[model samples]
Target: MSSNLTAHHYGITVADLDRAIEFYRDVLGLDVLDRFAVSGPAFADAVGVDGATGGFAHLDAGSARVELVEYEPEGDDADAGAVNRPGATHLGLAVEDVEAFHEGLPSDIETISDPRTTESGATILFVRDPEGNLIELIEA
Candidate 1:
């Protein structure tokens, strides 16, 4: 077996699982890959394991997939430090219409950026979800 870890999945912590679903499923137009409760010897279930009690929502945005998991906080809880948080990072998605995609993004979209050509010779833009998770949208 290959020892290479080519980013099998990009996982994130969300505040509202439902809202996250709407963003990834409806707005971003990604297909729901799967949703299942994590259990057993999973590291997320262990003591001192910093994660969520809620289930995960896996969404396929093109070839790269994302896993959104929200912690089961009692009330009005959100990750204090957001996209800039230590483990938080952006997930890129290739899109047909960069402009339309940026404009049509939900009101809760924390941020958006004008298209900029990447050093890799591709057009790119930055976007963020309500929870401040960054999404780098590339023109397809």
Candidate 2:
């Protein structure tokens, strides 16, 4: 590993690229940076999926970047898995007010629970994207 390694973008595989873009951009308020498609031998080798092909979009998440991807010949439509499950991951977003942010979310959005203060004094909550990806919102 390199000594100067820095955090890069986080990638989420989704079933619908367009829908994901709308939700992350319009709902989460992330700015859309770029969108593209990928395929061929290099892509397949990099992702470890044989014959993998997909469409992807890059979004600006303030301090970090989010890459949303949709594979061709779609996979099974299973839940993204619970937060406690092994191999599951979530995207953390910092907000000014967790409660106010929660209230502004769409009525149909799925939230793990109401914002609650942590032992460290930050209020936080988790919400699921349209594709069931967990997103943590925190107010310090």
Candidate 3:
């Protein structure tokens, strides 16, 4: 790894682009920067799949970008069963108030855990997105 490397964005594959966009944009308050429909061998090679085609949306999330992709006609619909397991991916979003943020979430969004204070006095909570992806809310 390069010593000067910095994270450009975090990519997530969602089953529904519109729903994910609503959750990340409208609900989470991220701004949609760009959207695209991708296909062909170059994308397949980049993603390490034999064939790749999808709906991609790049959203601005504070200092970082959230890349939401919906691989249509060939994407996997496997349910994310547990967040504790290895290789399970989750996003940690910083908020001003964890409790208030949790309370403001849509009714359809599921709460996985209540707010708990860390050793550093930061409040943290877990919630699941519309497609069952784990999201962590933190307030320092």
TM-score of each: 0.72, 0.92, 0.90
Q: TM-score of the candidate numbered 1? A: 0.72
Question: Cα miss at 49, model 2 (Å)?
Answer: 1.7
Name the better of 1 and 3 by TM-score. Answer: 3
Better structure of 2 and 3 per TM-score: 2
lDDT of 1 by residue, 13-99 (tens): 887788989888888898998988664446456623555355789888656679888765324544545556775567878888777
Query: lDDT winner among the candidates?
Result: 2
lDDT of 2 by residue, 26-129 (tens): 88899999999999999989987889999999999877789999997677776678999888899998999999999999999899999999999999999999
38-140: candidate 3 lDDT, tens digit per residue: 9999988888877778899999978889999888466557667788788898998999999989888888778877799989999999888888998888998
Best candidate (score: TM-score): 2
Report the C-alpha displacement of residue 111, candidate 3, in angstroms.
0.6
Off by over 4 Å in 1: 1-4, 40-47, 50-52, 73-88, 118-120
Q: Model 3 shows how many backbone clashes?
A: 0
RMSD to the hidden true structure, all candidates:
3.8, 1.5, 1.7
Residue 90's lDDT within candidate 3 is 91
* Candidates by lDDT, descending order: 2, 3, 1
Model 2: CA > 4 A from native: 77-79
